[model samples]
Target: MADQTFDIEYVANLARLSLSDEEKQQLGSQLGQILDYIDQLNEVDVEGVEATAHPFPLVNVMRDDVIEGSLPHNEAMQNAPKKLNGLFQVPKIVE
Candidate 1:
């Protein structure tokens, strides 16, 4: 219904895309059809319909926290690539 010829070249330039003449023509037609579909949807009557955030109901299926066995410092550092003074020695990130 609306003016079908959208500026395909301008849109392509904005998006930093290089489109051939055929591609541009194809995209222009596709975009026009999409806009027409949206215009059609605007004619629908839904005065009392409630807006839904999600299609399905969401429930927090979380489990209660529980403590687990703790490992000793020596045992924890056993497989470490490098350790010094009871701590892992990682490469310095900040100057």
Candidate 2:
């Protein structure tokens, strides 16, 4: 692990963030502490423990796909702010 403090300007540039000198110093110190904590975690022993993607058991509880009911087109169109030719008229997105 590198003991030297991380370059704040380099980190900020990588993140595309504009930080003041004060903010850069503060964030640099905070990031150093976080890196230190991660380094400490390397000391822990995890022998015999299986690496899992998730901490809890996951199961697919999704219900089977089924068609229950249908709504009339006019009824669905009633809530549209604007409509034209029996279809919703949205603002022009492309130039």
Candidate 3:
């Protein structure tokens, strides 16, 4: 079922691209092979299989959120590159 009816020039034009002769030929062959593989996949039997977002069972691996004492503002700002008026001073990001 590897019947190829690909048109590389049509795709290139649609994408507003200028493909060389060699690139066009290569892309056509590659795209045809991809389509043939997809056709092969379409013939698979999955009557009892359920659609899934992931292949394996997913579980949250995060630790439980716990309230803890925060670092004091003075201590937190101690290592800052720039500090002013008891707060960390960062370069303004927005104009």
Which of candidates 2 and 3 reaches a greater TM-score? Answer: 2
Residue 17, candidate 2: Cα error in Å is 4.1
Compose the digit string of candidate 3's lDDT tens values, residues 1-95.
Answer: 65586677787899999999999888888888898878876688989989898789768878679988999888887888888899778889999
- lDDT of every predicted structure (CA atoms): 0.88, 0.84, 0.83
TM-score-based ranking: 2, 1, 3
Worst 10 residues of 2 by lDDT: 2-11
User: Which pairs of residues collide in model 3?
Assistant: none
In model 1, the Cα lDDT at residue 21 comes to 95
Model 1 lDDT, residue 53, Cα: 88
Q: In candidate 2, which residue pairs clash?
A: none
lDDT digits (tens) for residues 1-95 of candidate 1: 55599788898999999999999989899999989878986687878988788899678978769887799889999999889998999999999
Identify the superior model by lDDT, candidate 1 or candidate 2: 1
Question: Order of all candidates by lDDT, from best down to worst?
Answer: 1, 2, 3
Q: Please give each candidate's TM-score.
A: 0.41, 0.44, 0.40
Candidate 2 on 42-86: residue-level lDDT in tens? 787988879898789678868769987789889999999999988
lDDT score for candidate 1 against the true structure: 0.88
Which residue window of length 10 is worst by lDDT in model 1? 37-46
